[model samples]
Target: MLTEARLVAVVVTSAMAGAAPPGVDDDAFLAAMAEDTYELVAGLDSVTPVLVTSMPGMEEIVWPGTPVVEIPDLSGAALVRAAFAALPYGEQAVLLSGDAPDLPALLIGKLFRALGRARLAVCPAADGGAVAIAAHLPFPDWAEVGFDDHDPVGALRASAPAPRTVATGPGWHRLRVPGDIARLDPGLEGWDGTRALLSG
Candidate 1:
């Protein structure tokens, strides 16, 4: 009896839900973010989507059957640690920023593929942060590096004792402020939740 190894993708939505750019409705914005995160991860059939947040009632946002891990500490590595603990069944984990709704599915697929060759992989954000990170179980120290500020990805790479074990995947846009809207491509079909709300 052989069971498939689980690969969990933990989507952190607290950041997106807490901050909405000017002129956007808060509820609509959060709904779009939640919808987009599920939609983006849904495109990757091999991975299971999990919601990790300190905020209560977030479970209602993700698709049914999706697990939610509510942690009191979401700072830096603690966030990853909680996710790692929540999904003990997962042999591998990918931390996804709930904000990158428009990120292509292929880029996320690339992160998992990159992890195949390395212990750690990061999908760099255009803002110098990270949109997603892939790491095998028994997490590496570099995985603890804070994914905040302007250069968390750079910091993660530098923290790696073995640079070769850290891999980089295709970069993508991570929406934060209103100006970030410029990076969104009009042709992308999957981020409909976000695009529809912002279309007006």
Candidate 2:
């Protein structure tokens, strides 16, 4: 239940947990991704971008004017459940994986738009996992669903109650392994920070 139509982009800034792309360490990779994701949504008039994380010292890396929400490093399904639980009831929100550094603004916009109708909308990653999950504030009890799986879209859909409608958005690439970096488009409007780091 949302207080209004306000859209909030909750970028999950969890530290990079696995392998990073070439020439980029975990910190550099995570920072680049964070910057890319934040900038892509920051320009959106209808959306408010906030960095959500359990990582310590996150404020130091955050953009000066941006807001941050700190949650316990609950580890696993509980972490995301807490992230959404920590959100204000008034904000209709989308939870994005920080690893999808080059995810486009258009897709981010589409998720918010889809939330206008469906109770839940998820953008599946071209690889295995999902890059984004969107829903109204006080997110449904499905936070733990499909999260542990390599391919979560099916589990995410199956876990929803019949009363709630789940929508699937366009699939995108997430930089999970070094190879995923190749999927980043040089012509894309966003991800400049990631591009710079990769090119360096």
Candidate 3:
């Protein structure tokens, strides 16, 4: 179970400046992220929601009354770094991608439960990057970690301080391209958020 004082920071990064990919809409992606965050929070024992994003235009798209913090001129590693830096201290935060339509709430709970024993925990994506990460310390140097090589696990292993690092199995995947969405398990059919995006 997650500690009561810990905050569940949901990092919702957006690519507002770039043109929407061939089949993906920016609004749908943002909605999916919000839904994923909601699911994780609902299934968890105790959590405080903190939505972090770089898209200034997303305030209109996100859920009403959702507390949001905006970051400026950030992308890739810098974006992740800024998001972590913005989170309030003294609360354990879980960083999850805004584009993961199939993020399992159970898996998120498992990650937090594992964090009680380990220093860091991750849900690895099929494409080699991580869909989610739960850590006690903010990794500001993660900017140098090579995400382009599709070796986030390796990058994190080498860069992250030598502590108890654990992986929460292999069900998590990120939605970077259209093909990535098709690989999700059928269990996602029950998710209103997932159905809305896949139906598009």
Candidate 4:
């Protein structure tokens, strides 16, 4: 079994590209979403969440106490690859999207637990993509797992062998479109950064 584990959370997000969804100011929304993502990941006591962004000037906005890592202005698998490759090898590294404002902390803990049993752990997004994914270090083929393709999670599932899946509530969704705003829980707690913007 793994011991003295190194857990790194690579929050794969952007403030320039897929940052803006409908019904919100692009820049403001992206910043809020990034903050939400940061709060959610950092809450996991044992995990170190790093803001991996292609957005310039991210340091000025990401929540205090969170680390920021900059990647090339790329998207899809290329972006994922660069972010993952940059992280030093660890026992587990979780890949998440900034759009998942209200991702449950319990689910994130579960991902770490699940990693103990499998080489890969994934939580499927309602839209056939993945809201969060955890992989044993020295992760799998980044090229094979298409990031923004028609079916990102499916491509990832196909590429990784027998990944352990954790059950996450419907709240585990991505805020990518205008309709997605309706899915946000008005009473959401913890992720105050995004909740304040989306709920109001």
Which of the numbered candidates is closest to the native, going by highest TM-score? 1
Which residue runs does candidate 3 get wrong by more than 4 Å?
1-4, 16-24, 36-39, 60-65, 138-149, 161-171
Better of 2 and 3 by lDDT: 2
Predictions ranked by TM-score, top down?
Answer: 1, 2, 4, 3
Q: TM-score for all predictions?
A: 0.86, 0.85, 0.76, 0.80
lDDT of 2 by residue, 1-200 (tens): 33235555444545453536655688767777776776776676766667787766666655686668887766455766777777654557887877776677788778877888888778888756677878776788764543334656566667777534688789897776677778888887778878887788
True lDDT of residue 24, candidate 3: 66
**Stretches > 4 Å off in candidate 1:** 1-4
Clashing pairs in 1: none
For model 3 the local lDDT of residue 189 reads 38
Give candidate 4's whole-model lDDT: 0.64
Instruction: Give the whole-model CA lDDT for all candidates, comma-separated.
Output: 0.71, 0.69, 0.60, 0.64
The TM-score obtained by model 4 is 0.80
lDDT of 3 by residue, 115-144 (tens): 787666667777676667776656445334
Better of 1 and 4 by TM-score: 1
Candidate 2: 10-residue stretch with minimal lDDT: 1-10
- For model 4, residues 1-200, the per-residue Cα lDDT tens digits are 33235455545455233445556677777777767777777666766667777776667655586667777877666766677777644567877877777777787777677766666666666666667666776767542543445565556555554533322223267777666767777666766766666566
For candidate 1, write residues 53-167 as lDDT tens digits.
7766677777777777777746666766666666646677777877788778888778777877888888878867778877787776445654554665566667777777888
The best candidate by lDDT is: 1
